[model samples]
Target: MRESYSLLPITELKGVGARLAEELEQLGIATVDDLFAYFPYRYDNYELRDLTDVQDQEQVTILGKVQSEPLLNYYGKKKSRLTVRVLSGRYLITVILFNRPYLKRSLKLEDTVTVTGKWDRNRATLTSSDFHIGQPDQNAQWAPVYPVKSGVSVKKLRVLISQAFTQFPNRIKENLPKELLTSYKLIGREQAIRTIHFPDGQANLHQARRRLVYEEFLIYQLKMQAYKRMKRSSSDGIRIPLDQKRIREFVGLLPFSMTHAQNRVIDEILKDMASSSPMNRLLQGDVGSGKTIVAAIALYAAVSAGYQGALMAPTEILAEQHAENLHNLFQPFSISVGLLTGSVRGKKRRELLENLSNGKVHILIGTHALIQPEVVFQNLGLVVTDEQHRFGVGQRGALRLKGKEPDVLYMTATPIPRTLALSVFGDMDVSTIDELPGGRKQIKTYWVQENIIDRVIQFMKKELDQGRQAYVICPLIEESEQLDVQNALDVHAQLSQALPGYTVALMHGKLTPEEKDEVMNSFKKRDDQVLVSTTVVEVGVNVPNASLMIIYDADRFGLSQLHQLRGRVGRGNAQSYCILLSDAKSETSREKMRMMTETTDGFKLSAYDLKLRGPGDFFGKKQSGLPSFKLADIVHDYRTLATARDDAARLVQSPQFWQEDRYEQLRKPLIESGLTQTLHLD
Candidate 1:
């Protein structure tokens, strides 16, 4: 009989009724498959904790008798409390529950129950809000802690998980190849799944985690190999031969000469453009490295050859900024330019779309809207996506499919470490613009304590008096009553009050799109002397006159993010400064802050970040769209990854392996597990 893995409704499960099904849906468990695939974030081992030899302040589980009924006590206006005495025959411990009077009735006196909680050293007690009254065997020896949502308790979820595992079809397929499993000494899939959820010991859990991590990495390598194969086999649509005369003319139009690094990168791109194979290259540079000018030169060359070119940015503000810069640069050459973004209204958008389709607009710039179904290019020869890491392979594929296999150039201001770049962008060629443009002043960075706020404000006021603008960035948008970090609103209020004579405007994500645009526009025009905002201004919005950037709670942000925020300033000729305010006094924070002072090179900073925080922290799922693995640290296990990559390459090279039934069995589960989704293989 063939095994069936249908997406049955969660309500079909025994314990999941209508209300509980909705709750499970909130946790993203809509089907049996989803529940099965929902891996734990981490595991806890209660098997090592014993009632007889439990130490104070140690996390332990104890099976004891509730010698006394729970009692509720209230002290003045404080929250209500419940206390119960339990005896394990070896010792006695008081269990305190805060503001939970109902727990008193739930556990009656003389009840034998198993309670798992962390012991308190100061009070010599075990106070736990997570404790439950249940049979000893009912509690998991090794528990899986999932990423939980509101209204869901870990104990209840554990019960539901056990029930699900028992009812799971026992004929689950083993996806890993027999040779590979034997080589890695990994356990069978069925046993690994069971052990991962409820392991008998720590060794089994570790083995299960290692197998899963290896599987995740293996699938990732395979998908990347497939993408590479596809790219190699595709036909090149258009090849724009590089012309020195045209390049010289474009360079002559620029007021400042190109940096040697910029020139070299452009030369590399030109060579790719001239080749018969389509270009799949990444152009990485630091902020103010003059990447945009180099891209414009390439686009101009493509347009000069009677073809269309498009540039896609992650944000609408960036797209608009690109359009404005390109319009000014290409106006003398009479190269028609147009902007397409979500903000473009009815008739104007329709007209732009028509112009783009008919080749009336030689170059187009926009956000994700540029990849819409209606948008088309008459003869697109090249496509450049800025901030390439911010986009996924699937989105890039959608843009590339717009034209007849146009050459692609991905750009990013945040430099990626060499190892990470090789792993992430293995299929594509890469170029780096290592130098900043001439006449651009270096941004002097500083790390200051909160006590130096007055001095920073004084410096900002001095800059405002000099007809220059400033940016004060906060980590949060609104004032949270609980968080200790200073929010944009609070900072705006404080700055506005401190500098009453100067113009100060506040901007945050909570504001409407139009409202955000209005504030940004005002800031650009220098009507606002000081713009206090969140990280929304991290990219795209440019003010050449803004010379001061003050980042509050800068230690909370990653190194790459902080670099981008600092890039917002130093676009002008006047000397610029980036002040990083942090309360952290730890060695890690000090080292990170020191990086800002050492150099403005984003590539170096990224490499440092990777070493400090590891690859998982460098490119989180929110930004890179890659699956977070269990055992593979992209930094630590780089050698293993290389071995896997080579092994995958060798496997694909054998024609007989591709046709093998075993290969299908190995590949199918990987596709179903979402690793293929990362590489857009399906």
Candidate 2:
């Protein structure tokens, strides 16, 4: 029964008909079990409050008698406002309702009703968007609000949930073992699921939340542990020997001296590459922190050992940049660098593949096209990826399989907090290049109102007058292309009108690749003194002379994206500044702006972002190509994650644990969740 629980359709439940089921389906509730998984995003405290204790702007539930008949006032063609003057002892407060004329039938003179809303001090009225036709204490202690669609009403959803719980009492089975539940001080899984939708009391709701959070985190930790074990026990990796003298010569000839952090990370990678076991290392660094330099060292090591190395980038532009950078770095040592991407085709691609397979080409850099079946390496020793999060775990695995025991290294400019690192990249060793090279000036940042456009333009002109380039990032707002194109054109027109003497150009994703390249190159060469572009510039368009960045509609972008955009500047020696222009007045937007201006540390901001927006918003919902966890939240469930990680490690060590009957209920869910794919143990 528990194994096939999710297969039971919502239509089978009482009070849920075909039409109602269709409405519920809009919220992704097709099965009876999906309703259980759809936990409340927040709870409304409908607990009754005394009239005397109510403060201005406080949401409270007041039980009062209507002093006079409810008057319905009509204004515009489709608009109506209902005013009910309610009396509670000696105090009188008006209940204002918008577009709800039907309430006049239920609420009459002397009718007692419960009102829950915010008290408006200026109007001295209780504006209620939600109310109940009952005594206050008779209602549920806590009102759970599920994520709703446009047509679905909260009252109807609550009724359906109550019916499902009542009719399917014994159908829900307890999943966790009794010993495990007792040890963790958790309630039964069946009770937790029931309480989550409609809690008997506050204590049960907290207990239920704790149980579900632990379950989600434990399964994730187990998957990570199994992946780690498989890599250690796998026999396909080829060990590459590191020569100290060869490395010293390569480092000595470089134009700029390597920072201590870069050198330390290189040393760590060298040690990992030298080991017989396959290397899974994540290289994290802030923008312009020399991550590419560390990756270059590993590629050289692979080539020096008579092996081929592959570097994959998220976009063709980045791939081209890496190809150019690596070619310049390796040409001094006579190592051939080849660029392979989806665009490289026909005879040219065929020749590159042949050269790559025959050991003639020492290094290959490209986009996802490098993972194609036809592209084989003679002695592939290292696999490196820039913008590693862009590729899913499956894509990374596919690349890792290309060579025997090849070392896998990933580099990212977006700093990931350590807590997230342990959950997402738990299978890999972590390396961080946290320091900038000596004498690099800190980029000053500011968050300003949209009205300060003239001042920002004046600042950009001052920078351009000194022959420095500036980037005005036009947000590629998640809207229609016509709107985005119009925004770019509008901003371009404004900047051009403002700074009439300077050259201004526009770029966006809608532009052809050739057009984008042309515009980027023009900006890079200072032909276009100021370039206005969308977030496409966030990846790898490095122009050191560009010291000014103006982000329009800054509130629309996430903290991580804003950080990456800020990184575009501050690459050169001159002091740089980022101007974040936004008119959004929400608290969340204000907090994001405040954090951006307060600090320049990417890691600190990353941790703050994780807490502010949870894992999904910090990265995307499809982060690292990882699927969404149905129940766990990385920010709120950190302690549970830590415990789960330790428990998973210990559980895998117990060879007899999997053979026991106590964990029988966990098998189907774990397999269906895809956690078992990472676990190689039969």
Tens-digit lDDT string for candidate 2 (94-128): 99988999988887678888888898766769989
TM-score of each candidate?
Answer: 0.71, 0.80
* Model 1 per-residue lDDT tens digits across residues 87-152: 866667788778777777788888887776788756757776356676655446777888878677
Clashing pairs in 1: none
State each model's CA lDDT, in order: 0.80, 0.82
* Cα RMSD (angstroms) for every candidate in the order listed: 6.8, 5.0
